[model samples]
Target: MPQQNMGDFTLYFLAFDHGQNYQAMSPEERNKERFTREGVLELTHNHGTESDPSFAGYASGNSDPGRGFGHIAITVDNVEESCARFESLGVKFKKRPQDGRMRDIAFILDPDGYWIEIVPNKLKL
Candidate 1:
């Protein structure tokens, strides 16, 4: 369990690997036919696919730092309000919204220097 009593807090979405038994794949195995974004989206939804406009990458260390697969998407009730609070607290986001999909996206580093993406979900149409 996470330690109780917090000064500041943040939560992000986690996508689970469906247990294809990655250990079975030897280091020598190459990805000649890895799943594409559309193929992944068509099958299920969770991890950032190649086609997701809102996808953002983080730099987590690995033997091959580029090989780690995971991203955390924080949910915000009101993104603008959250931004104002963050600004007041002097936490400048490393990245800000650019496209329509990122209408309310922001980023801040965790205590361990991990990039956590703050994402505000769109209101249902």
Candidate 2:
């Protein structure tokens, strides 16, 4: 049997308060395929092709009007620097930058109370 091409589909939409959510979500200079500007944020994963089930990417919005557990993550060149920048802009973080079991990380809540995980880009792979 020929291998089936099972591409990754849109799994879920996250929520954030600021418009820079896309920048925070993408960071690392990746291309953003689309931006609805009407509460829709789309992203693409560098790995895992559309033919791979493990290939995953998602969209984010400004509202979390649904009852479900969901969150978004982004890898930064420096967690502290990123946190500082966001903080200077009056953004709130749920958990300050600290040492995690696997990596140094932090958490910030969106307008809908979803946790946004920020970690070092070195720990992404």
Candidate 3:
């Protein structure tokens, strides 16, 4: 996969495909039915070079929530600003920074319906 440097963070879109069943779902369907079917699995927070690094990854065929597969997190310089930019560009958000109990984090869906969590580079906690 190629790594894209998005100013504050780097993004790596993996080449792994979940298969035919997963590929059949539209982005909107993926958003509405997240984790309910097999789909693209993404991992973030790279601490080292691609050849020598530490990270976590997962993709599941089971729809059970207990499987523990969740969205990937990306650290950014400014959560609010980045979110506002995303909004202006018509990005769909699963959860905004001001919407839930966890106010500091935001979840935005990628074109493929995978949730990408946006977080502050520095945690308030």
Candidate 4:
């Protein structure tokens, strides 16, 4: 995957790993509580470019076929400040933020276009 030149690729907020804990709960228990407690949270909050069909929201549901909802990538105006604002709204930056002069960090966006945030590394020219 490193060969893809992911170009400052940063996966934030969406990808998660489900421990074998959910299987312990009954389906109804899962929904009434666990569903509300989505941990293996795969959220793809944005879709469509300025051209294609676009609608943004939480992932419709989990599907492994790469057709799950898509992630929102933002070109932020200020990385540090914007990241702080987003962190206030439950959007946590992925632990391993991409660090470099040329690349910037990224986050997820909520429905109001308020969550995801990114800014070019100020240290870069």
Give the poorly placed runs of model 4, Cα more than 4 Å off: 1-65, 94-103, 109-125
Q: Please write out the lDDT profile of model 1 over residues 1-125, one tens digit for every residue.
A: 11112234322313233444434664333122133211221112334345578666444642245567444556677777877787788775656565356666877655445566777756532
Clashes in model 2: which pairs? 7-50
Candidate number with greatest lDDT: 3
Report every candidate's CA lDDT: 0.49, 0.58, 0.66, 0.44
After superposition, candidate 1 runs with Cα above 4 Å error? 1-65, 98-101, 123-125
Ranking by lDDT: 3, 2, 1, 4
Estimate TM-scores for all models: 0.40, 0.43, 0.48, 0.30
Give the alpha carbon lDDT tens digit for every residue of 1-125 in model 4: 00111233332332222453544666565445534553334323232333345534434222333565444454545766676676687775542135444345765545443334364544533
Specify the highest-TM-score model's number: 3
lDDT of 1 at 43: 18
Q: Which residues of candidate 2, in runs, are more than 4 Å off?
A: 1-67, 99-103, 123-125
lDDT pick, better of 1 and 2 = 2
